[model samples]
Every structure is written in structure tokens, then in C-alpha cells.
Target: MSWTVWTYVVYLLVTVPLTVWVARTLSRNGKVFLEDVFAGNDRLAEAVNTLLVVGFYLLNLGFVSLFLRVDSTVVDVAGVFEQLSVKVGVVALVLGVLHFFNVYVFSAIRRRSRTEARRGAPMPPQAQVAAYGPVPPYAAPYPAPGR
Candidate 1:
């Protein structure tokens, strides 16, 4: 086989498994976090976890496939290695970015949920105004003629 074909082979061999491993790891570990975030809703947590894993697979695989093509011809073993390194490096970076993004989003959701739980159910707008009472009109420092 040609060096270009070898480069593609090596790239796929490294990236595909790496993607699967990372996705599985995230899904396995994220379940507990999701459960907590969803306030012990196991069904919802599992459903969201599955959806996240599916999304992760779609994004990583799409990136890997899109990046598989080499711009230049790979002539030898060194060239193949060099090409593979660049491709794999880019794939790794993309994966890391995606991972961090997912973490940030979930963290934000978790934080919001925790805050809401602490605050309990929100009061309606009318109830809020009633609870606080009506605002009095501003009064001048000096009294009127009547004193």
C-alpha cells in the first residue's frame, strides 16, 4: 500500500479507538453527575446521558472523517508519520475542546439546579409584590403646610 494509505490507516486506528474510549469514560462517569444534577431522577439522567454519548460520538467521528484526507502526498514512512502526527494531534485537540465544552455546559446546568433547589419554588410575581408590600411615594424632607 502507498504511504498515504498507510497514513490514513494509522490515523483511523489511533483516533477511532481513542474517541470510543473517551466517550465511554464520559458516559460512565457522567451518569452520577447527571443524576445529581437532575435531582435523583434516574430515568431522566440516563436518558440525558445516552443523548450526550450519542452527540459525542457524532461530533468526534465527524471530525475524524473530515480530517482524514491529506493535503500533500505521503511518499515514505517518515512522511506518513508526519502526516499522521498532524492529523492525530488535531483530532486530540478537537476532542479536548469538545469535552471541556460539555463539562462547562453541564456544570452551568448543575449550578442552576442547585441554586433553584436551595431557593425552593419561586414565588409568583403578584405574590412577590404582595409579600414585599407596596412601595410608598417619595416624601420631601420638609413637611407640608399642615405639618
Candidate 2:
């Protein structure tokens, strides 16, 4: 087999497993996070988790397939290594981006949920302050020449 073929094979071997591992890890660990974000709704958490996993797979695999094409001919082992490195590195970066995005979104949701939970009912002011009339403008360091 030519170097391009070898590169494709190795790239698939690395990226597919890496994607699978990441998806599994995220799904496993993200359950608790999702639960918290959903305010302990287990069924909702599980459903969201499943949907996220499916979307992850579809996006990652689609990207992998689209990015599999080698721009230049791979003539030797070095070429294969070079191509594989770029491809796999890009895939890893993409995965990291996706992971971080999900975390950020869910973390925001969790924060909002927690904040809402904490704010049960509005409380009256501890002490009321009388409104003062609008204050006059502050004097300048030096009086205006025309003053």
C-alpha cells in the first residue's frame, strides 16, 4: 500500500478510537453535571446526555470523514507521519473545542439554576434610605474664567 493509504489507515485508527474514548468519558462524567444543571432531574439528564452523545458522534465523524482527504500525495513513511500528525492533531483540537463548549454551556446553565434556587423570594430592604434631591454639580478645581 502507498503512503497515502497508510496515512489514511493510521489516521482512522487513531481518530476513531480517540473520538470514541472522548465521547464515553464525556458521557460518563457529564451525567452528574447534567443532573446538577437540570436540578436533579435524572430522566432529563439521561435524555440530554444521550442527545449530546449522538450529536457529538455525528459532528466528529462527519468532520473526520470530511477532513480525511490528503491535500498532497504521501510518498513515503515520513509523509505518512506528517499527514497523520496534522490530521490527528486537528481532530484532537476539534474534540477539545467541542468538549469545552459543552462544559461552558452546561456550567452556565448550572450557575443560573443554582442562582435561581438560592433566590427563593424577594426580601424587603434591610433599611430604607430617604431619597435625597439631586445634588448640585461638583465645583471644578479652578473657577471658570467667565465666572
Question: Which candidate comes out best when scored by TM-score?
Answer: 2
Clashes of 1: 0
Cα misplacement distance, residue 117 of candidate 2 (Å): 0.6
Best by lDDT: 2
Estimated TM-score for each candidate: 0.81, 0.82
Clashes of each: 0, 0
Task: Please list the C-alpha lDDT of all candidates, in the order they appear.
Answer: 0.91, 0.92
lDDT of 1 by residue, 1-147 (tens): 898998999999999999999999999999999998889999999999999999999989999999999999999999988998888999999989998998898899999988887887767899987998865679566778876
What pairs collide in candidate 2? Answer: none
In candidate 2, which residue ranges exceed 4 Å CA deviation?
123-147
Give the alpha carbon lDDT tens digit for every residue of 22-129 in model 2.
999999999998998999899999999999999999999999999999999999988998998899999999999999999999999999988999887854454222
